[model samples]
Target: MTKELLTGNTAVALGARLSGVEYVPAYPITPQTEIIERLSRWANEGAMDARVVTMESEHSMLTAAGAASVAGVRTFTATSSQGLLYGFEMLYNIAGWRAPLVLANVSRGVASPITLEPDHNDVLSARDSGFLQIHAETCQEALDSVIMAYRIAEDDKVRLPAMVNLDGFYLSYTREPVDVPEQERVAEFLPPYRPQSGYMSAKNPMSVAVVVLDGRAYSYFKYQMHLASTNALAVHEKVAGEFEKAFGRKYPAVEGYMLEDADYAIVITNSLTTTARAAVQEMRKEGKKAGLVRIRLVRPFPRQQVADMLAGKKGVAVFDQNISVGSGGILYPEILSALYHRSDRPKKVVSFIGGLGGKRVGHTEFRHMVAVTEGCVRDDSQLASVLLFTDSDWQAVKGMLRTAGKGEVSQ
Candidate 1:
């Protein structure tokens, strides 16, 4: 193993290469382009033995990837924001086929008002799309997750596609020290792709992903998919254990920091969890009894682990980087549902939305979240979701409105 400073994109490319991937179907998009670019370069230089194909669109790219994986080849692909949405339709088709491919999604804010920054909306949008999700907070985790994703996806009990997500620009552009494992060791950990089912070959010709015309057949197949996805919970644990023995680092589904004896807990995900960890340390110095929980594995929700972590806290704050349009933050209600039936649930739980469009969420935002959570605990009252905006933020927007000749807008 060699430790070197590498960007998250490079790390992901290396991980894919180390997994002995045979095929990569790609289309260029901001942030995500670097990952495919690195892979293409390695393939061109003959450093990696793989077929790298540049497709016309994200849709075509995913279709090609699915076809390769179903043909008993180890396949990989990547995309971001609009690109992810563009190929959204094929996500279900691939999962239903039990293709067992890996997709690296560099999370970016979706377009409407348009921005090229990081956010969870694009990834969270696929929560119910039959793909298991593993989010990363650092360059090293980004690399490790990609490698582990392939193992989890290809397991016989959970033959489903997996999405490894990292925040765009944050981890994508930022450089960090990553321990790159030797190929010999990685090979010892991950074997080549020899699928046990849904493989199309001359020796074994089989028809797969067929349409079920009847409602009963459709329901049965759909429920089977859900069960397969649920089986990932155990599969992930097994892979994570093996990965740790092979690489000396293990990632849990729901990871807690200083949460054992805390009265207040902060729940977060993705790259922002790094900042929250530091904030938790500062809060600890001030004797605030604060703690943090970072949700690494997002699909199959990990509700049991989450509920177990926040069980007896005085108050809890769930921070979501994505909003659910007419509703509030996408993760808040889900977190609440996880804790609702617990015998020793938190005294109060609140939701805070921030970090949209790659907005910076730092110590100030962390303090505000803790304060709101404290208030909830003190008053024993339910509160609506709060958007993490400051006075300066509003003033800057006002300046833009004024420049556009709109006057006397409500604060």
Candidate 2:
């Protein structure tokens, strides 16, 4: 066991090195470039036995990763925001072919009018692309999840690509103390890659990721993908348990902090949970019962665990860094769907959209989010609204709403 202060990118690099990744397809993108740089330095120094391929673009980068993994090498890659989108086709192709490649997605905001900041939109957009998605809340998890992603991706029952995402600027550059296990221990936990079925050879040639038959075949393929994702929930827990046996830490799909006896709670993901934790602590000190649920695994949705955690609470607030256009927030609908069928549910479930485009979400802003939820619990008529925007923006929003009223058109 070795403890070192490292930025999230370095931790991921160290984790990949420890996991004995044999190949890395490198492409530079903001927030994720440091990871490739560190891995290249390690490879150059002979610290890791890996081939680093500098590709011209993300599309080529992922294609190389998929090809390398299919060639029976444990492969890894990193990308962000538009980079992921640019290589979207390769992502689906990798999963469709059941190729196990580990992807470290340093979460960055998507572009219309672009800004490089931490947001979930980029990763969330790929939620349906048949890859296992895990969101990291800390530098340690960012490191640990990479190792787990490899294990999960290679499992015979869930043979698919895996993506481990960390918030862009907040986590990628933030320095924190991380425990990087010895290479021997990591090897013991995650053994060297052994592909279940060897790659395409002249003796056993096969077409990988070819287009399938009709709608029935397509539906069957999708159904099998769903089953794989569903099976991943249990695989994740088992892998986390195994990781705990090797390292002294355990992580769950959904982690609840002080939720057992709390009257209200906030659900969050990524680095924002750290800020929300402080707010929850203050609320606890004031004798106002508030707890927090941080989702480590976003895809496969952890519906059961989340429903159980929020059951019987007075109020629940979900904070999303990404919006779904006219909808409240992306995670908001999922959380609501999770709790909808439950007989006993939180009194008021509110959605608060904040921290878009890497905007700072301070303790004050978190407190305001909590206050809004509290008000909704008290008077059930507060009406759903997005928090942490300027008052002038609300005026503009109101004008748009009025002009676009129920089938109304603007000239």
Candidate 3:
């Protein structure tokens, strides 16, 4: 077992190499550029026996990747927020064709007013785009999930594209100790590329990715994508078990910390879970039974597992870095959906939106979220979604409410 400090981008490159990918077509984008850069260097140095294609834009990148995958090569690529949207059509094409390629998306906040920061909007925007999504909390998972993605995507039962996501500045730029498994061991785990249908051979001359389906046929094809994504929930657990047996570490789709006897918990994803962990520890130190649940896989969602872990808790504070426009937060409703039918559901779930556009989320802010959760539990009449701001405007609004209530009562 060899351990080295590697940034999340390098870890992904290493994982792709280990997965025996034979082709990479990508364009340079901030936060995600380093992933392609390292892969290109590895291919050039013959460390990886893969062909690296530099594309003019994200659209061309996916186009080439899809074509290469159809040509019977294990293909890989990386992109960011706007790049993902730019290549959005090709994402559906890749999945519709049942091409089993693995793509890494370094999660960046989407733009109107542009800023490079970690947010789920970039990835969430592709939720229904027929790709299996895996969100990584640490550098290790970022690497490990890439290997698992290939296995899940290429499985004969579930041949579909997969996206392994890491936060932009948080995991992408941050360096951490990662255990890179030996090449021979990885080879045993991930075999060479064997395309489902041998492409470009004299034995088969057929049109690849041609649109010739009727409306009902198209709906059936799309339903197949849903089946593949749903299959990932079990496949993830199976692969994680195998990975732990090989690497001495176990990764759950969604991991819960200190919730065995806790009264309340916080549910979050990616690097923010680290901040939540610290806050949970401090809250526990003060005799509050606070805990955390970190979501490692977002696409398959692990809905049953999440519901089982969080059921019967006093309350849950959901922190999301992405907003759903009219909805409070993307994850807030998902959590509620999971717990809605439970007999012992959490009394209240307070949704707190923060860290949009890559703003830093400190432990103090996480602690404040916990305090808000505590207040919600104490007083059941509070609003479901609370937008935390740096100023006291909310307090002023509360005072005005009190004044109006008193006047109405006197009348």
TM-score of each: 0.97, 0.93, 0.92
Higher-scoring candidate on TM-score, 1 or 3: 1
What is the per-residue lDDT of model 2 for residues 1-411, given as tens digits with 9 covering 90 to 100?
A: 889999999998888888899999999999999999999998999999998889999999999898778778899999999999999998888887778889999998898868789889999999989889999989999999999999998988898899999999899999999998988888988977888665755576778756777778888878888899899999999999998888989999999998999988999999999989998899899898899999998877899999999999988889999988877789988999999999998888988999988887887777777788888989985457575687765677578778877444343
Using TM-score as the measure, what is the rank order of every candidate, best first? 1, 2, 3
Shift in Å, residue 224, candidate 2: 1.1
lDDT (C-alpha) at residue 257 in model 1:
96
Count of clashes, each model: 0, 0, 0
Give me the candidate number with maximum lDDT.
Answer: 1
Write the residue-wise lDDT of candidate 1 on 93-137 in tens digits: 998888899999999999888999999999999999899999999
Those runs of model 2 whose alpha carbons end farther than 4 Å from true positions after fitting are 392-411
**Would you list the C-alpha lDDT of every candidate in the order shown?**
0.92, 0.89, 0.86
Model 3, TM vs. native = 0.92
**Model 1 residue 167 lDDT score:** 94
Candidate numbers sorted by lDDT from highest down: 1, 2, 3
